[model samples]
Target: MSAPLLIFADTILTGFDPDGTPILLEQAALLIRDGRIADAGTADTMRRRHPEVEAMGGRGKAVIPGLINAHHHVGVTPFQMGAQDHPLELWFAERLRMRDVPPDLDTLYSAFEMVASGVTTVQHLHSRAPGDVTAVLDRANRIIGAYDRLGMRVSYSFAMRDQNRVLYDDDQVFLELLPAAMRPVAARYLAGFGLSLDEQAQVFYELRNQHSGKERIAIQIAPANLHWLSNAGLEMAARLHDATGAPMHMHLLETPYQREYAARRGQGSAVEQIQRFGLLGPDLTIGHGVWLSRDDLALCKENGVCICHNCSSNLRLKSGTADLNAFLATGLPIALGIDEAGINDDRDMLQEMRMALTLHRPSGHHSPAPTAAQVLQMATRHGAATTPFRERIGGLAKGQAADLVVLDWDRVTYPWQDSRNGFADVLVRRAKAEAVAQVMVAGRTVYADGTFVNVDRKAELDRLKKWQSRPRTALDEEMAELADAAIDVVHDYYKNWR
Candidate 1:
């Protein structure tokens, strides 16, 4: 354990007020002890009370709760792997050509990006890879271990899906649509990920057990999406959540095609189907709820389910914009995520927050746009609700965990003159990764002065470069051709949907 320390900031944004306003303080201090906040008050009072404690961030610093990324898939993006953006349905086909990176290196790469942008916690929804139970467990260990070594809090879930691995139909049915010669090759490739529903559940159980009782790690359930999971798979996901009391993060109705698929499945809306399986509740978080109808929104609100808005992902993949105005009006808990990558292809939460702030303003003069307080709440407090670390790491309070960011206020407000705008407003509108002077998780400094405390960023990046420089094997060449062939078929499959 580290010794007691006080972080004194020229400005402190603790959280939101009851009226949805920001709670700001000037010249305040937070006293941290044993990895938790022990006290908070004016800087003068804290200094008088805890005079012996070591101090940091005396002036030109603004402190706020560490940001959270509620939905994420991988470190390097599909675009970086030579896959271009298409609609979510066709985008899956493009991902087939993505070069495989080792789990540890991939996780660490994103951790570096996230920590630099003041994101101290991430809900890592691990995508299904081509592997059996043993191989899957090994990958999960490497991912969780990477976060452990980086000193970042992670709520890890292996996304479970039993069918529709390639497109929005039965695997055998979709494979038959391919050319005769390619069918067997694609079939062989798909067979590599042949984990039964029972085995998938076993993987989740093993991971949860293995990572239990860790401070900065959490294991949760993720049912991949509406089209990916069969009815049995959905029930299994709910059962896993019920048995372990772990929260679930599921992708649902992310696009119009997905909504149509749910309708055509004869199971009612995706929200209703999940509700039938007892999966709609406070423990559930819906990722990219871009196409939820009025009734769907009502159901989510009634059940206390949260929504994670992936603003950049929605725009990049041609997924329609989610009605953020409606979500706010309905009073549903909202969180922010950079799904595969941000608009700039990096995990910058400040930029994600900025996108969420500006993307919802309609044309009407009096239309309700999101306040900076609301967006900040989404990135911090509401984001906490979507993870296992809820209420433990969001806000800086007397007993909350000391997870926070210290911004160089000078960088945030350089050559500026306005003071009437609220602190949250000014900060969210102007802050960038460059303004993040330090980041702390559990009262430990992980990033400071643009340098990582635990890992060598340039060294790891060079290693990734070396890995990417290796020559492609025959299997990789085959997969690339297979992926290219599947794209048109995947595109044609979705054209007839009403």
Candidate 2:
């Protein structure tokens, strides 16, 4: 057993109380024993209680619970890969052209970005991979292994979407509309990848059985999005959740087109359809509720369904802003997600927090806007609730995992403003990834002084770059062209919808 660690910082944010109030402490010290917080109190009091423990941090640092990213994809930044700023529907087709990289390389690439930005826990909504059952499970395991080795607490969900791979509706008509030469190419592109729904659920159970015992990883069900999934797919997801008690993450009404699809299908709202399938509950997390109506938000709150607000992704994809002020008014549990599409094109949670705080200020005086402290809680505790980690990893309390980030106060607050200013406010306004001096998970320092403790990030990135530089195959070029040819048909399909 290792000696207890006494981590002292200038300020500490204990996430939130049971009643949803922020717990702020000044000159706080936290004691870590056996990877869990044994005690947390004033630095002087803790120091007096545990005189022999090794100490970390000092006067110019502030410690807060590590940020939780509620929605994320492994390694494919759409804009970076030619899937530019189209609406979510069109962007899906463009993403078909993205070149595939090794799962491990892809996982590590984004994991590095996330950790550097002080995110310790992530909901890694796994993207579809091209493979048979064995190959797909192998890739999922590889992604999990990468996160495990990197010391990140992750909820790994194999994203399941069984329909509408190309357009909003059935793509047969879209395929017929395509040029003859591009038909086969379009068919190949539209032919979805990965295992069937049954096989995916089976693999999910297998993965849960194998890795649920690990301290840093959990498995969950992810129905990719409303339009992408069939009624049968949604039912399978609900059944899996019921049988396994695993949490679910799904993209809700992310765009105006999705709203139109739900209305056209006579579903009233996508939220209503999810409720009809018996999937609404505390164990479900809806991502990007940008187009959710007032009633939809109420329904989400009533069902205890958490909403992960992906502020940057919503804007980047041209999805309109979610009425966050209304969400707050409804007392809905909200969390933060970068969706791997941040405003700055990097997975920076600090920036995400700042954006969420600033983006929803337009609700005027009647609606209560989110404060910096509340946004921090959304990034930490609320986000943790969306994943399997839940109570174990979100906050700094006795018996909770000691996952936290220590920011250099001098670096973040260089101008040396008045100490009376609220620390959370200052942090949200000024903190950046560069200010993260140390990051710890499970009482161990995984990142400190600009280097990852368990992996050689630079070497891994170099290898990934080399792999990406390799020549593209004929099929890759053909698919890229097919995506271009099919974009117009996809657009017209939605345009012509009655």
Candidate 3:
């Protein structure tokens, strides 16, 4: 806990109301103590009442609740690792070409990007690595350790996928499509991720127990996706959720091919199948629900399930735009995510907010689109609800965690601005990462001006670049060749698919 402090801004968007609009207070100050908001009111009144409290963020700053990146993977994206933006299915093959970066370095690399953009918390979904329980646990710990060092809150999960390692079919079935010589190499690669359903469950429990006491870290469950898990694996996810009250984040119906794959299962829609296993509820969040139907959305609403919208990822990967308008009509709890990366292959929440703000408006003069307040709610409040840290890290209400971003007000409204334009609209459209003056989490400044308070970012980045420049090892050479040969087969299999 730090000493009591007050943050005064020219304007403050405190939080959202019951009707999902923003609650703005002008010339306001928030009193923070022991890492939580103690009070909020007009700057003059707050200063009069607590004249002795140390102050920050005067005149030129606009304060808002800290933004959350609800769904994310990898510190360095696959594109940065040499994989282009292929469609989701084909991209899985191209993903093989990515060279490995150590867990800590990979995590810190992205942490720097996220914090600079005023992101205070992240839901990190780690992809399945080729390892046993010990190796997997160590990798998770290293990632968590990175966040702790950076003072960022994180909800972390190791995705559990027991099948469909390469394509939508069984591993052996997909391997048969390759030449006999390549078959052995492919089989060897597939065998690398051989953790059974039980081992995967064990991994979740061990991680939850290990991080049980952490204030800034929460270990959660991820069932990979509808195509990635078997019926038994789905049941395991439900069992884990029931055993502990942890929230579950699952990827489902992200693309048309995924929708078709669900249909072929003969088990009904992906939502129905998951419901049959008793996984539908407020605690389960569906990632990238691009192809969900009206009925699917209805079921999700009835069950209190949340949907995380990855607007930029959908566009970049050629996954069609999600029906966010339909989602809003149903009143489902909707959040925003930067899965893999955003539209520009970076993690800028302000740019993502602008993308979503303009993307949903259709041709009709009165067509429904997101208001700036709603998008801000998605990035802050709703995003927090999808994680275990709900109620603790989202808003500026009294007793809530004092996590917020201070933006340079002058930069946001440069040269000229109209008084008639709402602050939400102006800020969402114009604010950039460069406009972030300071970011605070738990009442402590983690980033200010252009530097992280804790890490020497340039030195760390230089070290990573030097390490990656080393000559490829024998295994690296083998994997590169294998990826080249496998991509053609993978492409053909999906070309005529659905």
TM-score rank, highest first? 1, 3, 2
- The stretch of ten residues in a row with the least summed lDDT in candidate 2 is 186-195
Which candidate should be chosen as best, given TM-score against the real structure? 1
lDDT of each: 0.91, 0.86, 0.89
Supply candidate 1's per-residue lDDT for 466: 91
Estimate, for each residue in 213-246, the C-alpha lDDT of model 3 and write its tens digit: 8778998999899889999999999998999989
RMSD of each: 0.9, 1.6, 1.1
The 10 consecutive residues of candidate 3 with the worst lDDT sum are 477-486
TM-score of every prediction relative to native: 0.99, 0.97, 0.98
Worst 10 residues of 1 by lDDT: 15-24
Query: Which tens-of-lDDT digit does each residue in 61-115 have in candidate 2?
Result: 9998988999999675777777888877788778878888888888888888899
Top lDDT prediction, candidate number: 1
* lDDT (Cα, tens digit) per residue for candidate 1, span 267-318: 6898998899999999999999999999999999899999999999999999
